[model samples]
Target: MFCNQCEQTAKGIGCEKVGVCGKNEGVASLQDLLTHALQGLAIVAVAARKVGIVDPAVDHFTAEATFACLTNVDFDPARFETWIRKTVELRDSLRARAEGAGATISNDTPALSYRPAADLAGLEAQGVALNFIPSLDENEDLRSLKQITLYGLRGLAAYTDHAAILGQESDEVYAFLQQALADLTRNDLGLDELVALVLKCGEVNLKAMELLDAGNTGTYGHPVPTPVPLGHKAGKAILVSGHDLRDLQLLLEQTKDKGIFVYTHGEMLPCHAYPELKKHPHFYGHYGTAWQNQQKEFAEFPGAILFTTNCIQKPRESYQDNVFTTGLVGWPGLTHIGEDKDFTPVIERALALPGFPNDEDKGEVLTGFARNTVLGVADKVIEGVKSGAIKHFFLVGGCDGAKPGRNYYTEFVEQVPQDCIVLTLACGKFRFFDKKLGDIGGIPRLLDVGQCNDAYSAIQIAVALAGAFDCGVNDLPLSLILSWYEQKAVIILLTLLHLGIKDIRLGPTLPAFITPNVLNVLVDNFAIKPISATPQEDLQAILA
Candidate 1:
């Protein structure tokens, strides 16, 4: 039951006895088995492709299965057991179809199938099956390289699953995951092949990101600059967390006019900027800072907290009864909202609670109005630049984690030059939310672009700025100093690479899965570097 695929792995290493995320040994082992089975499915899909029989269902199942194994995604061993059985059934069905059609499949890999060992004595009996273990390459470097690619795909699958729930599907991304997963299972492949697949994972993940961006913006309208309230109003309220905008939208709709105020939590904080979502008068401001503060933040709150996706920690008994989970996020004893997307139970609980004595509105928290909204004020922004008011643009954003080294983001934002504008997104901005970074001319110094998915907005703004200056994106005065905590970051990094953007700095710690060979490829190709020294020094290097 050793798992360390996330930032909050127990004790900064693998979670051995029990997952800090509340996943038990059985659930962890099942997730491992599920991952192994998905890889097996990928093997079959890839082989079938060689024979010109590419089943889209096989590709999608692989994506969903891989996504389910992501950190904090599936904690219910019972649910995953069903998924495993279903996957095996799918694999067998696919094989039967191919054989019935008389298609000559060259690769004869066994279908996705596994049985628990006969002896269920202790921890070792429940440990992940050997087949599920990532192949241990003869070369230590290659093993690391395979891990990086595999983990990166796991992250990509998570994002893709979110998009799928919103009715956004990309065949190309699914196909790429199948191809990449199959490639990881191949120990015969050399460093060059694995490296190419690593970069390709990045490329396809970029497309996946674009699809999600479109899904969000197209459905909700472009996010505009809007200030969210920080104070919780009296009465019943619901705190919606995680990164799924669609879930947030549904909750907002169901709770509207019901006297239950909806507030954005964690990554959902950015949803307030969307015109369609913001129009809801009852949509309150953000609740707390980041995911890590949830245990304290959720304590004794007057309402239920609904988790739409990842980054949920095991709840304390005090608030455990009030927490509701929807979509793929699951945990024992938590109320789960099913596929219907109905959130009535959460709304009901919020109403049942004795809310604040009055409508206690928190003060204004600035957000919304990202690139498109900002671009709407493009004339003003361009004028400010021409007037020498807005000097430099600092893109400071990425995931937030429990690691102490994450304090770098706080220090980095605090140290930004007064005249420079700080653009942020995702949970990483929580580090400096209290800072009075001050605005350049009229704009605020800390401008939140949106969620991590809104990295697209950051990219759009950079490209537009490059176009305005008649230069390449890399030549613009903007600098990307990012903090990554998960796979979504991996996809965003790939997008940056796909655009040929260089000199990007990442931190707080480098992924343990990346082998030296793979790291060398990224260094040589993109000049990506780890965050070191003080932010001042890093800023100097980027400016230089």
Candidate 2:
């Protein structure tokens, strides 16, 4: 099996033998089979839509299935088998409906008529024989463009699924996703067309993110400036990680007055800023850093750990039994919380664990500087800019990985001039989140703008700032220094490109799938730059 859909792909190339994310050959092949099955389902779904027969279940299933294939999400081979079978079943059902509606369903497209093997082993064998990655395209540039679109769709599906969970749905986003998947079956498309499709994925992702932003803020209330403790209170505890706010909300409800203090971990760190979530008396402080450090950090946590979405690493024996997965996240042996969202087992385990021995005051960091909070002080920011007190704005954030060279972000933040305000989001901020950058006037210099789920919030802040200054977004005194590790970051970059944002710096290494030709196209068109040899260098270049 060969896979290079993430930044940390083995040796910065395709992972041929095993995944860098700990997905063994079996799990990798199963994920490949699952993706192949979804492409078939998507072909049928797209055909059905043409005949004006669209199934909401089919649309939602397509998103969930696609998202499950994303890196670090689901590592359970059994789960992939179930989803692969379900995809074929859904494809058959949708095809019948489309045929009944007088749609000309053709078997010429193999994906439409593709059949899965009966068992997991057979499915894996079929997947290996079918070989998804190497068969993408012969043209290096076109393949790179298609990989961008494919990964972007995976990220968009995740955001789409999260929004749909909160009762937010958009037909346009679903239509685009299925259509893009269907388009992957075509070999006639050229580089320009594939590039167009890749950018369109970004455009659609922006819409998906908007839907998610509405869902999150609408359900949890727009985040306010709230201080989240880095320390812990002595008690029974459950650390919630990943990016699902609703799961955390439900767990908080289930454990209310049960003596379990729910601590936020990883991307869940920003949940403390949401009024609906934070109002829970038992909802407590944050624990640990980013996803890559989870194996060590989680093992040390004294109570049960719950992963609400993705970013789950292979659990070690030390904390394996103590970890539970909900939503689409999966690992072989760990208990999974189903759609019922009961979280009863998690509570029981938390109650059983040692939890914190005593109160620890590790101080705190400020969060909730989302679009609403930041834009609410637009006048002050505008004034700061005019008065030259805030000389520049650096948006240094993205996914954090275990790879070397990530310390660039830490040093980058440290070297940011005193007069500049640093706006950050996602797990990457863990590098220097606790730094005392102080503030320009009353505004904090280092602003935590929620998780990667809050990319829309950061985008909105930039757009709002641009509007306030009567200039284009790129014309504003801002720079995007991003680090990408997964498909979500891929889609975010595509979104930035879609918005015509230029001169962005991306690093920790460019994607392995992006050929030099495609890289040149990006550099020529968007002026995209790889992060310089040093943060100091990039900072000088940006501030120059």
Candidate 3:
């Protein structure tokens, strides 16, 4: 099984024998099978949609199936097998419905008539056909564009699923996702059509993010300036990680009055900004740093670690038993909470383990500087810029990884002049979050906007800044320093590109799957840059 659909693929190349994310050969192969089946299902769903037979369930399932194949999301082969079967079942049902509705679908497409192997060996026998590496299209450029579009859809699906949990639904986004997936399996579309579709993925991603933002802000209220305690409190505790706010809310509700203190970890750190979740007394401070540091951090923490969504690593033996997964996240040997949302297993584990003996002084980190919060203080920010209190703006944010060069972000943020405001989101901020950058004119120098999805907020903030200054977004004294990990970051970058945002710096390294020609297109159109080895020089280049 070969996979390179993430920032931290093996040696900056595809992962072959085993996933760098700890998905063994079996799980990785299963994910390939799942993705292949989903593409077939897309063929059926897209055909069915052509006949005005819109199946929301089929659309939603495709998104979910794609998400499960994302890096670090799921590593359970059995679960992936289940999803493959489910996707095939849906594909068959949709095909029948389309035929009954007199939809004209060519039976010639291999994707339309895909049959899953009943067993692992059978799955392996049908190997190369199931892999994404072997594209149906012969043109290398078109293949690269198709992959970019497909990965974008996978990222959009994760966002869509999260919003759906909050009762927010967008039919347009779902339809486009289904139609695009089917298009990937089509042999007829040329490079021009594929490139246009890839750009459209960015547009649809913006909509999906908007839906998620509304769901989050509407449910939790716009995140106000809130101080999140970094240290733990004395008591039975549990550390919640990943990006699922709904699961965090349910856990908060279940842990209420139970004496088990709950803490946000990793991407869930922003949950504190939401007033609804923070209002709970048992909901205490944030624990540890980013997802990459989980093994060490989880062991150090005496409480159980609960993963709500992706970015889970292979657990260490010390804390392996203490970890629990829920809501589309899975890892072998770890206890999983089903749809019941009953976090009893996790809560019991927390109770059995010794929590922090006493609250330690780990300092405070600020989050919740989402779009609304920034917009609320728009005038003051505008004044700060006008008065010269704010010199430049650096948006340093993205996924965090164990890769060595990632320290460039930490160094860059550290070197930004005190007068410059640093805007960060997602887990990449973990490197310097504990460092107090101080505030400039009452605005924190280091501002964590929100999770990766909250890049929506940074984009909003950038657009607003441009509007106030009466110039294009690129004309502002702002720099976007992004560190991508998975497909979500891919889609977000595409969105930035779609908005015509230029001179963006991407690192620790560019995606392995992006060929030289594709990179040329990106560099030519968007002027995208690879991060320089020297952070100081990079900073000088940006400030120049």
Q: Candidate 2 lDDT (Cα, whole model)?
A: 0.91
Please report how far candidate 2 places residue 294 from its true position, in Å.
1.1
Flag regions of model 2 displaced more than 4 Å. none
C-alpha lDDT score of every prediction, in listed order: 0.77, 0.91, 0.85
Clashes of each: 8, 0, 0
TM-score of each: 0.92, 0.99, 0.97
C-alpha RMSD of each candidate structure in angstroms: 2.6, 0.8, 1.4
lDDT by residue (tens digit), candidate 3, 236-273 = 99989999988888888988888888899888988898
- Model 1 global lDDT (CA atoms, 0 to 1): 0.77
Which stretches of candidate 3 lie above 4 Å from their native place?
Answer: 127-129
Error of 1 at 358 (Å): 3.0
Residue clash pairs of candidate 3: none
lDDT of 1 by residue, 5-88 (tens): 665666665678887767887878777766666666776676566666778777777877887777767687667766776776
Off-target runs (Cα >4 Å) in candidate 1 are 8-13, 20-22, 49-57, 106-127, 131-136, 379-387
Residue-level lDDT of model 2, residues 55-108, one tens digit each, is 999999999999998999999989999999999999998889998998786887
